[model samples]
Target: MSEHFEPPEGGNKKVALLIAVLALMLALAEIGGKQAENEAVAKNIEASNLWSFFQAKTIRSTTLSTAADAMEIDLAAATDAAMRERMQKRIDDWKKTVARYDSEPSTNEGRKELTVRAKAAEHERDNLKARNENFEIASGLLQIGIVVASASIITGVVILAFVGGGLGALALGFMGLAMFAPHLLF
Candidate 1:
């Protein structure tokens, strides 16, 4: 059998509107929250990869420097001109490599450049986390506002509807901050 229902003859339609508006805001907040969460995770992974690259470069440069220094000592003591020349050449090459590793601004993959990149990624991750937190808060408030507005329908209390509307507005304010001015402190 099919059931047919009807709205109460004197129900407050404003409560339904409040519930609908809050539900819409809740959906927006959920979308923003998920997007911020995904982006934050990506930025975190980028920062981690950059930092690992920086460490690898540092280790390589240090090992090269130690080898070059040892080669320099051997070069000074070598009696054969040919051996001394070869050792000197190797030392020079290692020095150039170390310098490049320390700061290859053009490629932006050197230790110094990697540090800057990693820090910027971390900053972006932190900002996204904060935005996600605001969105979560907005979602919670909007959900609660929807529930309260529904309750107003059952209780026929106009004040409850006003409270629900206020909560919805507050949630929207948080969503606004998350979307437009996330860096601003509440």
Candidate 2:
């Protein structure tokens, strides 16, 4: 009888399909990680700028307060009425400036406003970082799944392919959580 030949099973096709799905998940994870990282960087920069502005306001307010104290001393020792009146007016103006620097809502550049803004930016940065962490972990898992699934395809091992596919599914779960509740993982 002539020798008979038979085709191999379709396990390689399944592995290839798993690899394709894992690659797609990896791509999505990468994109999400990049977005979260960019947001974190932007929020960090905003917080830093706000803190710097707050410091500047504090310094200016301190300087004005010091000047007002000095003028008060001069006014106490002044022997002339006109000089005393001028000194009092200057002291009042300095006090007004200091108060405005402490809490001016119109300009939104005062210490109170700046502090609030800085804290808000910091909070946003924390949220971005949490989301980025989840995305990064998902990206790692997906990358591993792609590699394992590729190996399974080469070796014709269906079990390995299933394992890789499981990892990819887990990664997808993490990606979903990152989009919805990033704080859950953290």
Candidate 3:
């Protein structure tokens, strides 16, 4: 006796279509992840630079303050009138410079201004990091979906295909949320 078998109707085609859709979703997720990663890196660099600037300003302010204090001590012990007069003038100039470093809007480069800028940059960096994390999660889910969908195509299991589709849909939702409001997820 001879036996013959016919492939299930439309099963292969359906699985192929599912796989194609999943592949597309995976591609989009990958792109979003890359973009988010780049943004996070750029924001981190900017925050780091702002912090460095703030540190430099703090150092300058501290040096000026120390100089003023030392001049005060020297002036108290000075015997020469001319030397005391010069020291007093230098102390006054140092005090003014220190005050300007604390809060000078005209220069917009004071310690106060630098602190504000550094804080703002850190906030932005944190937001970007959240977005990047969401994107990474989305990408991983999409990758899993693509692999599962491909397996379904190979094994001819319709249930596996549905599971893959569900994962893909979830990934798409995360990607959209990351693009719109990443802070909500965080």
Candidate 4:
């Protein structure tokens, strides 16, 4: 296939323009889709890491709480006042550490804070996924529009150009929705 792609003489030139415009739109759609997909993947990884940290914090808090309870039980059987006092103080320290792990608002590294952060990341990933899907659909429609517009030039079927133009217009709407109103686009 060594044929040159020269434009046909006369009226069909408009269809060639339509094909060019549709191809440009397809490129834009693909770019947006790829960006959204990449962001979604990053957000997903962030959420996963946050959840794992939250789980580790939860385990540490539980272990500390259990140890504090056991120490308090052992302290009751101690006859020496000094030993009982030391054991009570150590148990109090462990209880405070367990509370800090459960909800340390200042550090934002506690189990409760991590849970909130992970949920937020998950929400962002979901929205990005929806936007990517819309862009993908727009890209497909624009590609088809380009094909149809090219066919109109070859077959001299003027009506095919209008159909292709309609498809391109629809694709534009999808692209706009993906950018501005992704929730609605999804």
Candidate 5:
């Protein structure tokens, strides 16, 4: 008597390839998620630092004064030929700097932290409204980055799942890392 065994229908090579793809995707997802979280946390820290910077000083006098000084050169009041030109140039320079400040990120990270800090400052006292507005204006770049990074991470996860490998485990590990980062970091 002779006995024989049949090979599985699906190619093991294909299955292995699929598994590899899944593993890669899972790794990507894990990395992306961690980066997104880290970026957000870093941004938050920078924002907090910015807020602290402003809080430590008198906002109305410092930032606004510098900005205003840059803005007002008394171009109309002509003391002399060179004075008018100098004043005009000064005014232009001030406008440029003020515009930059207006367009900068509140914290080094961007608006998410700035916005949160601003809202908190606003609810607490009237004096902070202006500062919050400043922070909000500065937050644009970081905000866009954060949004993009988070979206990419979410999309990566979806793709990892579709690849159907050991992603489920990887995702669980990622979540655990995310939850524990703060404690681990500090």
Candidate 6:
């Protein structure tokens, strides 16, 4: 009498499909994380630029006020009409620019809007920074989870292999080591 043994069916293909699925999921997660990071950096850049612009405009307004005050004192001491006219024209130009800025439809709304947006963006930047920091921590934790999971999976495979191969040998009396015996022995 001959004992015919058949190999397991579809085992390799099933394992291959599972591995591919896990890989795809991991890749998609990585892409999502990177895209979120890019968006955060972009928001941070806009916030930084707006903050710098706000500082510059504040400085410009203060300097213009100082210059106007100095010119007023100088005009009181001066008797030259031509010099007075030139100085007055310079002051007028500054006033006109201010008026133009106020009246301009494009950034007239945008000036106020930008100020509001700048403040919001600054808040958003801080949030994004914290989000990225949290993401980093999460990524590290996810990496550890994957490593541990992979180790557990490998250990399961090893246990299966030892049971399948060693059990067959033990059943045939090729290995008599009691330590390698099946669960029934224990």
The TM-score that candidate 5 achieves is 0.32
Q: What TM-score, computed on C-alpha atoms, does each candidate reach? A: 0.92, 0.91, 0.83, 0.92, 0.32, 0.54
- Please identify model 1 stretches exceeding 4 Å from their true place: 1-11
Q: What TM-score does model 6 achieve against the real structure?
A: 0.54
Compare candidates 1 and 3 on TM-score and give the better one: 1
Model 1, residue 131: displacement in angstroms? 0.2
lDDT of 1 at 56: 97
Write one digit per residue (lDDT tens) for candidate 4, span 88-186. 999999999998998999999988899999999999999999999989999999988988888888877777899999999999999988988888946
What lDDT would candidate 5 get against the real structure?
0.45
Candidate 4 weakest ten by summed lDDT = 3-12
Clashing pairs counted in every model: 0, 0, 0, 0, 6, 0
lDDT, residue 177, candidate 3: 81
Per-residue lDDT of model 5, residues 124-146, tens digit only? 33222222332232233223333
* Model 6 misplaced regions, further than 4 Å: 1-22, 77-89, 96-105, 108-114, 130-134, 157-186
What digit string (tens of lDDT, one per residue) describes model 3 on residues 1-186? 885443378876876787788778778777777787787788778778877877887788899999999989989999999999999999999989888878788877787887787788778777777777777888788788878877776776677888888998998888888888888889
Q: In terms of lDDT, which candidate is stronger, 3 or 4?
A: 4
Q: After superposition, how far is residue 174 of candidate 4 from its true place, in Å?
A: 0.8
lDDT of 1 at 67: 100
RMSD of each: 4.7, 3.0, 2.8, 4.2, 17.0, 16.0
* Candidate with more favorable, higher TM-score: 4 or 6: 4
**Best prediction by lDDT:** 4
Return whichever of 2 and 5 wins on lDDT.
2
- Tens digits of per-residue lDDT for model 1, 1-186: 995544456556767877888898899999999999999999999999999999999999999999999999888889999888889999999999999999999999989899999999999998898899889999999998988889878777667788889999999889988988777863
The list of candidate 2 runs beyond 4 A from truth reads: 1-9
